[model samples]
Target chain A: MRNLLILIAKYGSTLLFLFLELVCFFLIINFNKSQGEIFLHSANLLSGKVNQQTQKISDFLRLEAENDSLLTENARLLETIINFRIHDQENNFEAFENKDSLAIYKFIPARICNKTTHLRNNYITLCSGKNDSIIEGMGVISNTGIVGIVNNVTDNYAQAITILHSQSRISAALKSSQYHGTLIWEGSEANKLSLITLPKYAEISVGDTIVTSGYSTVFPAGVPVGKVLNYSIDGGGDNYKVEVELFNNLNKLSYVYVINFPEKEEKEQVEISDGN
Target chain B: MGTKWIGLIIRLLIVVFLQVVICKRINLDYGILSFAHIFIYPVWIMIAPTKIPRPLLITIAFFIGLFVDMFYDSPGVHAAASVFSAYARSMILRFLEPDIGYDTDHPFNLNKVGILWFISYCGVFLLAHLFFYYSVEAFSFVFFYEIIMSTIISLLFSVFIMLIFILLSNPKY
Candidate 1:
């Protein structure tokens, strides 16, 4: 009894240090996707309002550039309108309507509040939540390409685990061959992530476009992920680990969109059953 | 002694305020040296009364760090740094046992310990503190060169400023 007591006393601080370290590790390991949902969502709403207010100021300051973009878009649209009238009764009209719907799905705007890119596990907050009809597992995007997925939601705010996070895994495919694989963050750089598990038989090339596979219901089909930067065959030459340079610069992220799939729950259920 | 405590509290409040409000605004992002933030809160850890109980000292250190973390938007870096400093302090005190005494009844003084002993005391622990703090932040040795460079620069700057505070104070003890 005395020896046991002495031993415990002897190693108390060491034990404490180990315990604290374990606590920190546990916090790191179990940094849940759900706990941050409320704070991030609220922050998103507040930041969204703030961003909207500041945008007016920025718009006023950059009126010339804004006008230039508007003018260019106006010119393009005017040309399209003229072309449309010229081809009013033509075959391309059907094609144009289809393209319009595709372009319409390109944006699902949200406001950012609490965002961090430097950490191993990075996350972003947005101002669209459950009440906004935002749901967990919705695809998030920007003007460029896929940014993240809606991980959780509160009444008025939503949080996204960005592609930069080590915990993030997305289904991706080669734009050319439609070969699908897993995409993961390398944790070395903010801008780069990796697409893994491509079969050696699949033809891949440098600068080949990578996009969301639409394999998972989170992101819709054919959203641009990045261009293939580098790749190498595994030791057995069975698969390729390819580097993907993300289109949405994780560092310069500001506004994003939460893509709401109306049939998400049903789709996920189907996927789960199929997996089983 | 009462006046000293009041002065210390006032200085601590100012340090915390400036660290959050002003130092954060100074955005100096050189490769490894954000010179502005290098020693912002370490000053508090350096000046805390040595006589305070170890666990309480560590708790205060942890909260002070957490407070800095809240403002800086970093979750745990400062808290971890401060706690480690508190943990290692007694060992540092053991190593740098002053020949006479630390004037416990009065207040801490640099002159009493002399410049060399003071420097030795701060130098050893400050380096250890910085090493652990930076390692936790970097989280890996891949940025080994960068971490070392930052550590050296930050430690030097922090120690310099710490000495300045100590010398300027000219404590009666």
Candidate 2:
């Protein structure tokens, strides 16, 4: 105890200096707005760099699995192209009937740099941004299901608001019944979403598949979303509220595709004029 | 000894007033570029009597910086920088110790120390204080370019003003 006291006496000033500096930093971050944001942003950027390095090693190990998924996706794309060509020949006989249905969507591949699934409003950061032609409001999807919508973009990074967010509402429909509804998150489960506005009369079962309705210019039609888990009628009794189990495991996502629609501006303009 | 303490307190009050009231208003702007800020408040910490206990000196430095921060609308940035410089003061003193060594009885002043030693001593502490102040204000090393630019420009102006103040006052604590 005597030696301990001597050490304290010798180093008390240094200890006090460090403690007070810590207090100052705490106060600085808590009290100031811009400083706090800068601190958090820098911290995120630093962590992103570290995550990128680790992801590279893990990605190398999972190359075979990743190649298999890519091969499957390529085969699906080839089938889609062949089907489109067949439809084009049929369209020649029925020209101008399906001109608007031919909305072209380009897919840009990106790797997830950072993501959060547990937050009330979770966000995913992509490694590709303006350089890769990504912009705000673009739909992001995995091979399994829908992922998110691009919220903001920087030079080399883009932030996306996932379907797990409270404010996220995507236009979805039942594959069998063809009834449309709004997919929303209830801020609890990460993998479950609520599909509202579906009419009670629509034939819905537990195993019915849900897919994007393509009402908006963000996503193309018939993209896989989830499967209906269960459903209930609200107090109004006019609509069915469905609980959907997402196809993609958001927690294990690594790669995603951002859909770039060329006709988005034209569609938006037409809608704005129709609104007037 | 008691009179010396009173004199020191009075000097501190005057320095704080000059910093908050006068120096704060002097904007160094050239068209669109406003590069420099006059930070004469650190002069008090730079010239404080070496005989004072280190912990007490650092604590006093914190409150003085907090007081200045109140006027600047920054909560703890100045206080942090002040504490850092005050804590670093002893090491600087030890590094610059002459063959005869420092007379801890008197505060550092142009009248007590020669021009070369005084300038070097104040210059080192002022650099530490300003760099730390800017770093805490920015709160990120990502704006390292802006931090370095502001530090160099502000350091030049602050040192010039400090030399003029010391020459005129010729203070001896």
Candidate 3:
């Protein structure tokens, strides 16, 4: 009895160490993904608040760049408006109400509360949520290019799954050829993405522009995704993994627009009707 | 004794603040890898008075790592590594046991122990901790290269700042 007690006393610390390590490993192996997500979302509440405060301070230092982006956005908006006005003047004002009813896209402007581009499953939190009509699964984009898709929403905060995240796949195509493929981030460089699922015979070359295919309604067609850097054939030569350099400087982005498709539900409903 | 607790608390706060607020933001990315996070949290466990009981020391070490894990958004990784280092600490002390044994409570003090001894001791412990950390994060033997690369880079980066921090503090036991 005494020997057993002595043994327990002598090695108790080692036993405790092993026990705690076991618990931690269990958490790592079992809780690494889903459970960690819940904890992270809750932690986001605190981190989001901290990021907002620091973002304000950093925002002050970045006023010049912000002005430049805003100016550029304004000019682009003006050019499109001028193009529309010219077309309307040549045609008629009789169909103006019909054109208004056909308008499908709305943009919700929001500042990024917190964003991380360096992690495997990166997420960006926008400062607007349900209150601003920003719902789950809406696409987000910067003035420069596509940013991400909104995945979760709180009352006043929405978590976006950034393009830099692992498991992030978006439909994209060649701007010139319309050869559609999947754009994926390989958990590495924030500026680079891999466009895969391209057929073996697809004519592709460096610097070729890529854009959203609009196969689904997530993004409008011809929204510039990236420019091809290079490509290589797979071992079987059935497909190619083309490297693309994204236009959005993800690390420096502050303002983004969450996209709403007013006709998405109607489109889905129509697509689901019984075959004719 | 009260002063000792207060000093420990202050150092704890300093380490946590530097890690979460400052070091987390300093990403020296050359390419895909950004490897410039300086980990000063090991000093929290290292600075405990040598007279503290082994079980309690390990418990404290686990919690310290758990605290760091919370900030890093990587649960289990830091805590596992910290406990491993804590469990190995007594053996390390015994291996380097002096002719008269570790007599002073202030074993981490650089003034008491010479610079060489302090550096080598911290170096070994931090290496073990970093190796355990990167391995856990890599999560598989398939990423052996990544584990080794991160371990070596983080160890060198952290040890430099840790030595500087220790010199500046010049703690009294």
The candidate maximizing TM-score is 2
Model 3 agreement with the true structure over B12-85: per-residue lDDT tens digits: 88987888888877788875356545778887777667777889888888888888888888778888988988
Candidate 1 structure lDDT: 0.71
Sort order, DockQ high to low: 2, 3, 1
Instruction: Give me the displacement of residue A52 in model 1, in angstroms.
Output: 23
**On a 0 to 100 scale, what is the lDDT of residue B103 in model 3?**
52
Q: What's the lDDT for residue A237 in model 3?
A: 80
Docking category of candidate 3:
acceptable
TM-score of chain B of each: 0.83, 0.93, 0.91
lDDT string, candidate 2, A1-276, tens digits: 999889879997898789889888887888888998887888889999999989999999998788758844753453344235435655553342334454366667788899999999999999999999999999998878899899999999999999999889899999876799999999879999999999999999998999988787786777889999999996799999999999999999988888887879999999999994
Q: Which TM-score value belongs to model 3?
A: 0.45
Over 4 Å off, model 3: A1-4, A34-276, B31-33, B98-100
What are the lDDT figures for the candidates, one per model?
0.71, 0.85, 0.80
By TM-score: ranked, best first: 2, 3, 1
Chain B TM-score (model 2 vs. true structure) = 0.93
Output the worst ten-in-a-row residue range by lDDT, candidate 3 chain A.
A78-87
Candidate 2: which stretches are off by over 4 Å?
A48-276, B31-33, B107-109
Each model's total of backbone clashes = 2, 0, 0
C-alpha RMSD values across all candidates: 26.1, 23.3, 25.9
Poorest stretch of ten by lDDT in candidate 2 chain B: B103-112
Model 2 misses residue A96 by how many Å?
38
In model 3, the Cα lDDT at residue B77 comes to: 81
- TM-score on alpha carbons, each prediction: 0.41, 0.51, 0.45
